[model samples]
Every structure is written in structure tokens, then in C-alpha cells.
Target chain A: MLVTVVGNYPKIPNLPRPARLRNAFARLDRGQITPEELAKVEDEVTIEVLKEQADAGVELLTDGQVRWFDEQTYIAGKLGGVEINGLIRFFDTNTYYREPIINGPVAWREPILIRDYAFARDNASRPVKPVLTGPYTLARLCRNDHYSSFEDVAFGLAEALNAEAKALAAEDPPLIQFNEPAITRHPEDARLAESIWRRLLSGLSGETAVSFYFGPPGDAVAAALNAGFTTVGVDTTIPGVLDAIAAGPKPPKLAAGIMDSRTTRLEDVDVLAGHVEAAAALAGSDNLYVNPNIGLEFLPREQAQAKLVRLVEGVNKARGGAK
Target chain B: MSKGLLTTSVGSFGKPPYLAKARSDHAAGRISAEDLDKLTRQATQEIIDLQVELGLDILVHGEMERGDMVAYFAEHFPGMSIGGLVRSYGNRYYHKPVIHNELRWDGPYTVDMWKYAQSLTDRPVKGMLTGPYTMVDWAFEEYYPSRRDAVLAMARVVREETLALQDAGARYIQIDEPAASVRFDDIDLAAEAMGIVTEGVTAKTITHICYGDFAPVYDQLIRIPVDQFDLEMANSGYDLLDVMREKGFDKEVGLGVLDVHTHKVETVEEVVAGIKRALEFMPPERIYVDPDCGLKTRTWEESADKIRVMVEAVRRVKAEYAIE
Candidate 1:
């Protein structure tokens, strides 16, 4: 059984350079630091987080998103004709995202996450799956001033992200994870979400996984997962997800997120194994992969690391990977 | 000026094109330090005169020097350093403050800016500071043992500046705590921290809280020792007024009659209708008129027009009531 992270590990707090790298970015803006120095600092942070995930026995490793400001904004900032606009509270977290404003036709004029993924893959012992904020989530989150409709903006974003995804796939990464957290927010926009999801994962290499968290999606998540993807990344930590998963069609691969990501409170190992077992029963053991319900950036570093160890162990125990 | 409805902004104004150019040029090192300061001072003076002409009872320095509300403090203040940009909501972003050491007063932060603006206008200028709870809430905390510890430490640091601003002859000291609304379970901790920050201060203390649901913490919020509550009423369409009526908010309420988030300016009629709904719960004398939040997101024209419409609406209300 494969146990991987959804995306984003907790930040290494109290750095002497800048407690958070966002402040480091500010210093760079003031010309206190050179672009080379900033890139070096970012890579150092990436190494620490990537090692932490690998140490915790995370089968499919992530870059830990150490350089990421939040889910959508960091990648959105790099795209052409997109403006990083106002400060906004990022959903329910204490963290905030610089909201993206689409000013013109969105396309990948330059490579965004290729370096981040390449850097992570080199440092990691396990195969790293580069995580991208999905087109649907990005379009949903940003103010689409340029695009005619939500559909137009979403597809526009899809075309841009499709470029980045294709670039990462070319690097021979085992998989690509698209975090469509917006799917849970506007579940009513299911058809719009599915169309965008299809476009995002149209021709990517290896296993392609689209995940939802914060809440359950309507029918679009299930339809899209079954249509063309290796995994259905469901946050079973939420109340309605089990019912949603049981009621709907199953994907070829099921990434059941049985661990809580928001709080530091540790889930009982037996209870976590039980959750894994139930999901496996539905999807069958071969199809099941275990993970946290969402990103663990909200939790403190130690707690997040401990939770990772537990999630991997619990999934292994349930799948009978250990003696 | 005190007789009729008091009019002011929630503090920031949109930076004009020239000022924006100067800021970028300074950062890019294309301009000298003296050149940047001269341009900023000019912008500040222009806004001060503009506020007076707009007939606002209270005047602000227009915050031409500030990049973001939280970042401005984090940069100037000691014990904090400006971090990279984090997303706020929509397309907006601000640098989250990083507090690695114990917070110190660091001489005077906003005092010089406050004094500069006060000298420009005869009207009482607000010595604005992002409150201790918000400082603690928004920043990445590493030194403190608990969030409560971090906040109280920040409160003491803020209190030093508050007293300094009072010494500078500022009457209205607006300590904004927009982050307080986010913490529902620990609302009391935030309130207690605010109390600690404002403890033994003589300046008229006003706290502005917004963006989150106030229904859950309505019971704990009213008891905080502040002379006024500058709330985001227009965004919620005066829904908080009903809560104030139910739970009894005795402090003077800054009725945010204008929405600053969008470019669509509120008509004078829309402003009056909102205040009319608010008047049903709050007395006009106890009301202060302003926008829902800072106008940094909006264009200069939009910000100016919204304030003018708000002031006009308040004028109509005062005339109808036959107040002096």
C-alpha cells in the first residue's frame, strides 16, 4: 500500500535569516539580498522539508512546498498577464494568500514549478510527485477580470497549468497531484470543475491524481476521478465524504485521506487503521493509498512530522505490510 | 466639526500613479532617498488638503508611505522583520511579520508620521497602530511559549507606542484588531490582550474588528475596554447592528457606511439607507461614519467619491435631526 502526502509540510520556524521565507522575499525586494542568495536560501529550505517527508516514510515524496506562500498564489504569481493583487484570508487557515487577478489570456509563458520539482527530486530518496494547484481551484480563487466566464477563465488556467504539468512529467516524476480545494468550496460548480479537471490532466505522464479537501465535492469530483485519473483523493476526515465515496462511482485508484490535517491532535492508530480498512474494502486493497485529509501546513512542524509517521504506519498495518 | 456626524476613512488611501512610480523607483534604486521622501511628503500633504476640502471631520495622513497595514509596522518596529508576501483573499496580499525575539518599543514607530499629519491639519488626527492581538495573530511566533504570551508581550510593546502617540497630542488612537474576529474559541484571550495593551492609557481608544463572524464572540467582545468600536457594518449590510441590539454594544460604533473592497462607489442614498438601518439600533450621536476597511484596494477616484457620499449622507441625517 502507498502512503503519500496530500501537499505542503509545515514551515521550519525561527530561522535566523527570516522566520518565514516570505519575509526573506521582502528583503530581496528591498535589495538587501541578491537573487542568487535568495534562490540558495529557498533551496536550503526545500532540502530540509524534502528530507523530513522522506524520513517519515512518505512513499511518494513532495517538495514540502517550502517556497510556496499558499496553495494558489505562488504559482499564479509566475504566470504571464496575471497580477498578484490584494491580501486575502486563505479560507479557514490563519495563513493568507496574495490573490491572483487574471488581466489577460492566461498561458504558461515561462516554467513555474519545474525547478522546485527538479530540486526536490534530486534531494529526495523516494520519487517526488510535484504538486500543483489545479486549474479549477486557481480560477475559482482568483478574480477573473479578463476571461468572459468562469468556464473561460478555468480553461485558460488549465492551458497554463497544463504546460507546467507537462514540464514536470517530462522530468520523469512518478506522479502529479493537483489540489482542487476549491471543488469543496463551490460544489455547485461541479460541471465547470470537471471540464477544467479533464483539461488539466488531459495528457500528463504517469499517475495523475486530483484531490479535494476542506469539504466534500458534489458529483463532479467522482465523475472526473473515474473518467481519467489513477486516484480519487478524498478527505474522509470530513463528515460527508464517506457517504459521498460510497454513493458515487469509484476511480481506478483510491487515495483515502483518513488522517486529520488541521489540528495537532493525533488520531488513535487503531482508529486510523480501521478507516483505512473500510476504504480498502470499498476500493479493494490494491487500489487504496493512504494520506492526510489535507495539507499539514497549519499544524506545527513536530506535530505534522509525527502525524506523517503515524499515517504511514497505520496504512501499512491495515494493508498487512508489516509483520 | 464635533457637533455633526464625524466622517473619516478606515486609514489607508489609494496611492496615486506618481507616488506608486516613486515607490517602485526607490525599491529599484533608480531614485535617491531624498527624492522618494519629497514625493511621499507631497502626496501626504495633498491628501490632507483633499480630506479637508471633502469636509471630513477627522483627517488621516493618507498612508502614502505604507505598503500594507501589517507590513508597515513590522518593518518600522523592533523585534519584527518583514517577510515575503502571503495571500489575504481574492487577489490581495501582505507580508506576514516574523517575530523571532521579544518585542521592544524600538523608539517611536508611527509617532513621527502621526505628528507630521497632525501638523498638516487642524482636525484631530488618529495615531493608527495594528493592535497587539493582530500583531501576534498575523506574525510567525517562535520565541513565546504560548499565543497568549506572544500577544501580551506585543501588547506591552504597543502600549509604549500608544502612550508616545498620546504625548504627541493625538486625540483619537485607533488600534485596529481585524484578526481578533478569526479566533472564536479564544476571543476572550484576544480581548484580554487588548485590555492589557490599552491598560492605563488616557487616549480615546477605538478598536476595529472585521471579516469574521461576530455572532459567536458577541458576548466577550463588548466588555473590552475601548471607547469606540469601528466595525465593518456595510459589508454585512448592518447585520451586526441586530447583534449589537441583542447583546448591547454600549461603545460608540464607527458605522462603516461605504464598501472599500470594490470600485463601485456607494450612492448617497445607499449610504443613508444603511445608516438609517443602523440608527434603528444605535443612536446617531454614538455613531461615527467610515468605510468597511482600508481603501488601498480601490482606485483614488473610487476612495474619494465613496468618502464624499458618506459625508453627504451624514449631513442629511444631521439636518433632518435638527442637530447643531
Candidate 2:
């Protein structure tokens, strides 16, 4: 079984000293340094987190999302029609994200995350996956003043993000994962979510995945599978979610979210192996990807790194037990 | 000027340079606890003097004695351990605490600070404590069987702290529940915990909820068993005021006049416009002018400048209304 992480990792490491990211931003705010200088700090942290993940035995890596401020506005703000607003709580987490106000037609002029992807790929030893906030989730999270309807907003974002996805695909990464945590919360929008994902992945040559988290998968699992994503990432920590994913139309690959990323507590290898085995039973071992239920941004740097170590061990234990 | 439309801060003020250095040195073990405490008290005195100088109606101790709102209470509570860092926002992080066992209130935590702050001034110092819901929401839960159980347990702990503050002659106590407005589905749980927290508390209870889309929880939030609902108005462009006007605010409001998250000190006209917008919904007596949230995020100079502008705006509005 392959062990990977869902999107973000903690940018700051566990240390007695303050994070360089914080200090750099503070310095930038004081006009002591240029934006280029601050970007250099972010790049350093990104490489650090990438190395940490690679060392912990994670095969597939994300940039740890060190460059992006938050899930919504990081991409949404880069879009033509959107303007970043004041802080709002990002879902149920204690952390906050800048809200995006959709003022004009939501259009992506250029590649938003392509540079970060290229940088991570260049810096890391292991293969890196480009992740984006799903168009539907972005539309749902932001205020849509311009769109006449939800469909108008979601489709507009999808067309824009689709162009960006194609741009990232040109770099020929291992996979591109669109994190649609908002879909799990509002499963009634499953159809719209599926349609948007299809639009986002349209004409893209590389492998793609859609992950649902922050809530139970509900009916969104089947919706994503039907949307023709190469992989469907499900949060199996929610009761009966594993069974629900198994019950749904299995995709080419299954990203089994067995680990809880929100808490600092680590899971036992045996328990994790059991989860992995169950996941492998549904999607053959070759097609299964084991990961946390969501992003590791909620966790401390030490715990997040430790969880990945345990994850690798669990995957190994599962393979060993099968042998 | 009338005491109506009184000026007050939500909770924390930005820590001054000396206090900030002292906290860092204390954390690094370079300074003794006594040294840190001395500086903290000195900083608190400075904050009180600043607020007094600014001609504010109510004042805060500036929270120099504590770190993050949640971690400070977690340090005092039994069965809790302050854990590693998690980002609160852009480049801002706090050590999220872990509830490892059944929680218990060892003794009063905020009473001493509240007493000290109150003693420094004749003005009624708002006794501040992180609300039980916010503490539970912010921290990593490892002990409680359910969130509801943890929330209620924390509510009891906070209630004890509240009563202690009340007993210590605190007339105004602000229980900060910033996390309450985050989840609309769990607003009942938040409200229920607040009920437990304020049970038999005689002081004028206030709960400050900020930074989220609170429109869904506004009705339930208004009924959160507090005397006043302190909210952030200017940060979100005073859009929340429309929601409050439609919902009909029955209780007093700690109206946030300036955005604390940004360094751009709001102009007197900008603040007056916000307060006037609020005045359209609620009377001046029901409105208490303040910043959007805690000024802890801003630099000390930024916080002071923002407060000066806030006070000036309130002064102009009070003068215009002749309410006092």
C-alpha cells in the first residue's frame, strides 16, 4: 500500500525558537524586506516540510502548502473576479482563512499553483502532487455577488480552475488532487460538485483525484467516482465511511483516509494496518493510497511528521501481514 | 458625555515591548518568574494608564500576564497540557492545548489579574476568561467521551472562574467565545455550555464572538445566556449589523468600531460611520464601542493608535448625540 498525505503539512517545525515564516512575514509587514525576500523564506519552509515528509517515508508529497495562506483565498484571490476579504474561520477548525468576495466573472488568467508545484518538484527527491481547492468548494466558500445562481458561480470557477489544471498537467506531475472538503458537508450539492470536478479535469492528460473531508463522505463518494476521477479519497474515520466507499462504484484508485489529522494523538500501527487491509480489500493493494482524513495543517509539526512515520509503518505492517 | 455608548475593549490589548521581551525571556528560562511577573504587572499598569489617558469608559488589563486565550486557561486547569503550535491565522500561531484527562478547576486563574487591574483604576475592569466552548473548540480533545461532555465540563470550570471574578467584586465579566460563531450546527451545544457557564453569575456577562459567518448562528447566539453579545462589525465591513437589525438585538452590544487584524488605524470618520450604522439598529445605551476583536494581534503602537481613533470617534458621536 502506498502512503501519502492530503494537501497541507505544517510549515513551521517543532522548535524552541520562533518560526522563520512568522518572522519573515513580520519583517515584510514592517517594510524591512521585499516580497521576493518573503517568498524566499516561504520557499525554504516548503522545501523543509517536503523533506520532512519524504524522510518520514511518504512516497507522494505535497508542497506542504507553505506558500498559500489558506485553502479558499489562496487560489480564489489569484482569480480575476475575486477579492480577498477579512478573516473567517476555515470550516470547524480553530484556524482562520481570508474570505473571497466574487465581484466579477471568476476567471483564471494564469497558472496559480504551477510555480509552487515546479519548485517542490525541483527541490524534493520524491514525486510531488499538485493540489488545488476544488472549484465547487471555492464557489461555495466565497461570496458570489456576480453569479446569478450557484451553478453560474461554480461553473465559472470550474472553467477557470480547469484552465489552471491543464497548465499544471503540462508539467507532467504524478497526480493532481482537488480537495473538496465542502462537498462532504453539503452532500446535497454532490451533483454540482461532480459536474465541477469533471469540468476541472477536462482535457487534462495526467492522473487526477478528488478528496472529501472535514465531514462524512455521505453520497459524495459515489458522485466523485461517477465523475471519472482516477482516485476517490474518502475519510474512513467517520463511522461506516469505509463500508460506504467499498459499497460505492470503486474507482481506479482509492485514497483511504484512515488517520485522523485534526488531533495530535497518534494511532496504533496494528489498528492502522487493519484499516489499510480493509481498504485494500475494496480496492486491490496496488490501487490503494493510505492517508489522513484531511490536511495535517491542524496538527503540530512534530505530531504531523510522527503521524506520517506511523502511517508508513502501518502500510508496511499491512503488506507484511498479507504476506 | 453620557455613559451611554461607553467605550471598552473586547479583552486583550497588544503586549508592550518590555512585556513581550519578558514573556520570551521567561519562556526561554533566561528570566525568573518573578521578573516576568513584575514586567507583566508593569505592562498592565501601562495599559490601564493608556486607556485612562485615551478617555475610554471601560478598560482591559491588556492580557500581558497570559499567552493565548485558550492556552492560559489550559495551563491553570488540571488534566490539561499545553501542546505544540498550530497556526491560528496568517503567520500567527498558538500552542493548542490537549485535554488529556477529566478536567477540574484547581483554583481561580483570572481573579488575581482582574483584581490587580481593577485596583489600578476606578473604572470597572471587565473580568475576562476564554469561554468554555472556545477552549474546547480550539484545543485538541483526547479525554472527553463527547464534545458536549467536554464543553459542559469546561463550562463548569469557566463558571467557577466567573464566580470567583464576581466574588472579587467584578461588575463586568467578558467570557470570550470566538469559536462559537464558527459552527452553526453546534450553536446549541455552545449556547448550552454558556448557560452552564453563566449560571447564578450576578455580574453583567458578555461573550465576544468574532471572525466567522455568524449570520446563521445570530438568533441562537443572541440567546447564549449572556447580558451582552460583543461582536466584530468593521472587519467584515459592518455587514453583520444588517443581520443583527433583522434579527432584533435584545441585549447590550459591545460594538466593534475598528478592525484589529489590520495595521491601518481606522479614521475617526470610518469608525463614526460604523458606530452610526450600529446606532441605526440599536440605541447608544445598548452599544459599547470597542475594536473588532482582541488587539493582541496588532503591534502595541498599532493597538494604541487604533484605540485613540476609536475613542476619538466615540467622543465625536457622544458630542453629537449629547446623550450623557
Candidate 3:
């Protein structure tokens, strides 16, 4: 059985200088500080966050997504014709920054500006998994102002992302996973989803995997398989997700998310092992990959790190590795 | 705004004869959306008639058209996709939707429907809206360069809808933002984002904040520009109100004295005591009797009984306060 700690890097502590600056920026939003000083604080925090993730045990570390407010909008800024909008109260909780629809011809403005951060992560002990939000999810989430359908904007975004993925793949990372949690929503609209994935994977140069979470697998799995992806990820917690594996032709390794990421209830290692065992039985141990069900963005720093430690340990034990 | 009577919601109070018929018709494909709307209208009218008979002040349309208050909005908005399939705390499974673009109202969203309901009765009709923050937070959000920007756009869309309701002569607008308590860690951001949505509304704005620990957000809650605060007090055992009293809350309080989740119909005396207990913290005039949240989850009988008791309780309290 193959076990891996898949998903975004765990949040890291702030560097003394940049920590002060990020705090200052937080204060600016609170009206405790002025907007004029925000730029200086952002730069400082970005540098410190990048450096901290590089030092952490994250195998596929990112810039901790510190520069952008959220995942989709950050990628939208890289592609042409995409404009981001203000924060909105999301859920009964806090605010989320969202991307407005693209209203013009979409194109890549420049190579994604992750070089400084990528260089930092590359120097770390573990190989990084260059992360990109899947084109389908992005298309489905943002307004398609300029394009006729979500697919049109998605295809354009996939091309832009593929260009960046190709450049990042040249950096010799072990894998690149495209995050597409939104694919699980449209089980009925599988053909449209498959086409988008086909185009997105076509843009990448090397061995790449596409991962999804928050829900069960969909027709996108078959699309990823058809696109010759090396791995296809799915959240195993949802109903019928395991059946999705049975439905598709087994071509790539399956990144089976067995750990619960949304709730604070800690999973017993034995229970986790049972889930992994079931996934391995279905996909075969050689094809199964272990991970949490979704991203840990909502979890507090301590809780997320603790959950990861438990997850990594449980997966290793399930794979019959001596912990 | 009177103190003599209590209020109850329609459709949710008791097991209406139409519920079984509607469910059967829906399963058999014999009932269309228009049919369902008609059934809801009739059910709402019956509830209004019951409230009038009970002599309650405020009347609700029983949230007839809505499935889930926040989730329903996702179905209408463009550039939004439901992400994951998960069961809510109430055992109701909802596909979590994600906002994918700049949100804009296509036409009059809820106004026409509410206006139609309002036209049916001479009683003051309360127009309910899910707060912009709750709509954004409950759904999967598209990533943005600026979180604040995305929130502002959502708020603008909400503001447009709210203003339209006011223009349609809605005297009372209830913006349900139950998710506000959960986002305590990001209270300031939430306040800023919601501030944009609530700008320039002349109607009696009453915000319903429920479900989570309100202690963390109480101070911030007071700062929100609204006329009244409808809170989940009965379900939470009134600890939140005590916290608010300690924080020196002086605004109008929508005291949710009835528990709409359970089938147990509270007595008029119990309802009176619940209100009287609340009066220890604030004056009776500053209080409005209501259920903690919507009674959509409860059966029609339970909803009616709960409201009946609430109204009786208000009468008892009013009589006692008058005697004093």
C-alpha cells in the first residue's frame, strides 16, 4: 500500500519581522492600521511564509497560499481577462475573497510568479507537489462573463495552468496535483467535466496527478484516466465515492482520502486503517494513496498539524511500515 | 410591535393535511412547481388565519417556498456550483454550492413572491432574506485575489434585493445570518463585508443570528446596523442573552422563547416565564416574542402549538406588567 500526506502545506508560524507585518496588515483590515502600509506588510509576510513552509515537513509545500486571499482567485490573477472582487461573508463565518467572471479573451500574462517561492520549497528536504486549482472547478465557481459557457473559460484556464504546470514540472518535482473538489457536484454532467479535464491534463508536460476532495468522485475520474494521468484522487468519506472507483477503468494510482478534515473529531488510527484497507481492497494496495478527505484551511494551526501527524502515522501503519 | 400577543409561523406548526398530499404528488410527478406554490399559498393563508384567531401580532408566511434558507439562494445565482454532498446537522443533505463569479440579481428574486403573500393578508408581512455573509460562507467560494472584494460584490447583490423588498412596501425585513456566530475568528472581516450589504435600508431590519456560540461575536453583533436582533435563546438556554446583558445590549431584542425543533408544545405560562426571564435583562417594550429560528424543520402541529403557547405567554406577561 502506498501512503502519502496529500494536500496543502500546514500553516507555519510567522517569521519575527514578517509576522509583525502580517499582523499589521490584519490590523489594517481592522482599521488599526492604514492601507498605505499594506503593500510593505504583504511583501514581508509573503517572504516569511514562503521561507517557513520550505523549512516545514511539507513534502509538496506551497507558498502557503499567503499571497492570495483564497485558492481560485489566486490562480485567476495569473490568467488574462480575469478580475478578482472584494470579500463576502461566507457561511455564517468569515469573509472569502472571490473571482469575478472573465470578460475578455483569456491568456497567460506571464509564467506564474511562484519562482521565488518554488525555489524556496525546492531547497527543502521533501519534493514539492506543484499545486493548481483545476480548471473545471474554477470555471464552475467564477462568472463566465466573456465566455459563452463555463467550459470555454475552463478550457482557456486549463491552457494557462498547463503552461505553468509544464514549467514547474521541469523543476523535477515528483508530482503535480490539480485540486478539483467541485467535480463531485455534477455527477449527471460527466461528459462536460471529462472534456475539461482532458484539456487541462493535455497542458502538463510530465507525470501529473489530479486530486479532488469535499465530495465523491465523478466522471472526471474517467476523464483523468483517459487523459493518461498518473494518479486520480477522491474523497472516500462521501456516499457512492467507492463505487466511482468501481465504475472507472483502473489506469492510474488512486489517492484515497480516508482521514476526515472538516470536523474536529480525531480519527482513531485503527478506524483509519480500516478505511485504507477497504480502499486498498477495491483499488489494490499498489494503486491506493492515503490522505485526509480535504484541505485543512479551516482547521486551526495546532489542530491541523496534530491531525497531520496522526494521519501520517496511521497511513504508515496501514501500509505495514514500522512506525 | 405590540406586547399583548405572541407570534407563530404558518405551515411549520402542525401536520397539515396538504403535506402528505404534496409529498405524494411530488413523488408521483402529479404536482408541478406552480401546484406546489399554490399549496404553499393555501397553507400560508391557513397559518395566517390561525395566528389572527390566536390574536398574535406578527405573522409569518411559514417559509413555504424555501427548502433551506441559505441553500436556496445558491440554486438561483449564476457562476456558482454546489461542491460536496453532505448531511447537515438536521439530517438534511445539501450539496455545498460554490460561488464562481460576480453575483448579480437576474430579476426581482423574492419580492414578487413575498408581495403576493403579503397581498393575501392585511397583517404586517415579514420578508425574510438570508444574509450575504451566510450565503457566501455556507457555499464553496471561488478563490479571489482579495477576500474583501468577493464579499463586497456579494453584499452589493444582497443590498439590491433588500432595497427592492423595501421598495415593494415591506415594513419588516429579516436577514437571517446564522453563520455569523461561527466566523468569530474573522469577526472584523465579517462585519466589514456585511456592512456593505445592509447599507441604506429604511425598513425595520431585524437580523437573525443563530446556532453557534454567540459570546465571541456579541460585541461585534451590536455594531451591525440593524433595528432588532432575533436570536436563538431558547435552544441555547439563554446563556447568550446573559452574555449580551453583561455586554450592555440596549437594542430591540427578538426573544426566541419557543423551541420549534421539538414537538412538545410549551404552555402559555412557560412561554410567559421565558419572556419574563428575558425582561430581567431588558424592558418588555424592547422585546419581540418569536421562535429561535424558522420552524421549517418541525411538523405543522408542533409549530402551531409552539406559537399558541408563545402568544398566550405574551398575554400573561403583558397582563402582569400592566398589573405592576
lDDT of 3 by residue, B32-89 (tens): 8678777877776776776677666766666565556766677776655555443232
Encode model 1's per-residue lDDT on B1-324: one tens digit a residue: 225457887888889899999999998999998999899988988888888988988877878888867778788777788764444432234556677777888778788778888889899888888888888777767567777898888888888888999988888988888888775656788788888868888888888888777887788877767898988888668788888888887779888988777677888988888887777776667888899988877877777788888988988977776655
Q: Give the residue spans of candidate 1 off by over 4 A.
A: A1-3, A8-88, A94-323, B1-4, B85-94
Model 3 chain B lDDT-worst window of ten: B84-93
Best by TM-score: 2
Q: For each model, chain A TM-score? A: 0.92, 0.97, 0.82
- B134: Cα error in model 2, Å: 1.1
Q: How accurately is candidate 1 docked according to DockQ?
A: 0.12
Ranking by lDDT: 2, 1, 3
Q: How does residue A111 of candidate 2 score in lDDT?
A: 87
- Model 3 alpha-carbon miss at residue A142, Å: 40
Q: Best lDDT goes to which candidate?
A: 2
TM-score of 3: 0.52
Clashes of each: 22, 2, 38
**TM-score of candidate 1 against the unseen true structure:** 0.63
Model 1 chain B: worst 10 consecutive residues (lDDT sum): B84-93
Q: Which prediction has the highest DockQ against the true structure? A: 2
Error of 3 at A176 (Å): 29
Give DockQ per model, in order.
0.12, 0.63, 0.03
